[model samples]
Target chain A: MADKKKKKLTPEAQQYQSYQEKREVKRPIFKNCIKAFFVGGTICLIGQAISTFYIYYFDFTEQTAGNPTVATLIFITMFLTGFGVYDRIGQFAGAGSAVPVTGFGNAVVASAIEHRTEGFVLGVGSNMLKLAGPVIVYGVFSAFVVALIKTILIKWGGL
Target chain B: MLVGHQTWMFKNKPTIISTGTVGGPFEANGRIANDIDILHDDMWIKQDSFEKAQRTMMEEACQIALKKTDVEKEQVQFFISGDLINQITPSTFTGKTLDIPYFGLFSACATSMESLALASSIVNSGGANYILSGTSSHNAAAERQFRYPTEYGGQKPPTAQWTVTGAGCALLANKGTGPVVTSATIGKVVDMGITDRLIWEEQWPQQQ
Candidate 1:
């Protein structure tokens, strides 16, 4: 789709593009994927530990502990964002830091802190969701669509 | 005067009398820290915002540039500077504080050299007695505008370059005992037609 959208370029631009391609340094995809896997797994391990702590001490079941677990992750992410460490982790881990619930928390909190100079109402309140707003919107919409499909199939097609 | 299609050869020989460079804590710890005029341990530099901090750095750089020379602020005829920000606010605010005739330029990374060339041309042609040419940028301010927020968890590729959080100014005069600006060649914009920023991310890393 992207390739199709590209407009025709002049001969000079084409020559420059080819030259840039030749000189451009490449990214280590395999190494990045390994790093992402380990980092992502570590985040999940920490999340599981939080969930287990709640289950063992607070008398919460595995199903009920998920909410508090997610909340704990986000709270930790808030601290990381505040201390200016998460961005570095993000640069190193790439999808590892970004594919977790903490990444979502970072998204909202980072924008909020970044816009703090503009004031609370116009700055923090309005621009807080600038990055993560689309994710929430599409997420809810897709969930609703999936639920609708499930309901129709269960009622008519007998599962 | 224009010597060729793009180059300008200055016959009057505009000279750089003095220079001032103010850097952030990151640069203060770097290898060239000794070369910087003023080093601020804090990224904020005691300012309320990153933009304001950038303006403060520019102001300090300009002041230091003047203080290093026999020239006074009133003697400076033009202030040419710019930064990577919305509407180039940092440069404008610095000009406001200096109260000098300002020319806010925007050439992305080339802003410093562009301002210097323009200032040299003006001084060479006897258009101004003294011109302060400078440019500034803050990492947080630039990241917020060009990429993600300062605290955002979005990853930057290995090929990504860090923006320098500092300001530098040069005092150019027609008559001075310093290095002279003989000629300047301005470059034109070129579009390579590669719009995908993630193409670099797709390539396999080469072994060192």
Candidate 2:
């Protein structure tokens, strides 16, 4: 028992001693921070640019331009998702990109691809709703409830 | 998969439309001769709170979709549904309540389209006489998985698609005159290494 104890300590002490003897390489947190900042910032900037482009080039009103901008964003995201590039961005930027409308496209395409390996009927056909399923349910129900209220208001309250 | 064809005889469009009953009642609309039941139980919350809401919403949507399609509960050859929860609780509950040959699917926002595509294919191929495809999502449930809560006050960028907090249902039948689903071309998963670093920096200064 005592010998086993010494043997364990020997390896542990050697490991610790080697670690202490090695030169400590200081990694600047700012490097990753900077990378994240620029990469994240650039994505937002592009979104803003697209929105501005819709407003300027497409001559859309500020409010109306939003719709076109979203459309453009979705379109681009769909393309990126199709090419299998958005997933990498998602891993690097984390929630920064996945939280946007583009993420919706990613979720859709990712789930579809995941299911596709199962074959058309059982795979892609069924797995497409892996992410966006809840969005549709809430959308429809909320709209239905809102529509119900609107109907009540129109009929009785006279809005 | 069995390759077989079955056709039904109908005089008119054979379409059913139900309204004011969540989705609608096909029996009331005179589309289906038998009674099509709608089930909504609060007991689902105990099994899973998130799925409870989703099941409620999906049940309502299926009720409506069934009514609209004029398909009877017994007549439905298969039911397909999906949600964002584990094992797709919504779809499972839906399958249980309907008690028919059914399947549950998950594909995120593309669920409705996916379900419909499959239903159409099955009906067209004569593998099924009547098929139901449905998908549902809840805002609270989705936020927990995809983002922060609404109370989080997170600024939504212009790129976000306002999640439709509802469910959509469609019925496919060999007897209907509506456009048949001939073929479906599914979208593939593609990725580009465009970093969102710039977007994050511009949007959230505190994070920087």
Of the candidates shown, which would achieve the greatest TM-score relative to the real structure?
Answer: 1
lDDT of 2 by residue, A1-159 (tens): 534534555565656545743743433445545645665677678878988888888778878877777778778877777776776675465555655666665666666654453578886688686556666677789899999999999999988
Quote the lDDT for A80 in model 2. 76
Query: Over the stretch B1-208, how does candidate 1's per-residue lDDT look in tens digits?
Result: 8987999999998999999999998998899999999999998888889999999999999999999988999999999998899999999999999999999999998999999999999998889999999999998888888777889877666567778999999999999889999999999987668764633234212110
**CAPRI-style class, candidate 1:** acceptable
Model 2 lDDT at residue A146: 100
DockQ list for all candidates: 0.48, 0.02
Give per-residue CA lDDT, model 1, range A64-134, as digits (tens): 99999999999999999999999999888888888889888898999999999999999999999987887
* Candidate 2 i-RMS: 15.3
When candidate 1 is compared with the true two-chain complex, its DockQ is: 0.48
Off by over 4 Å in 1: A1-7, A150-159, B196-208
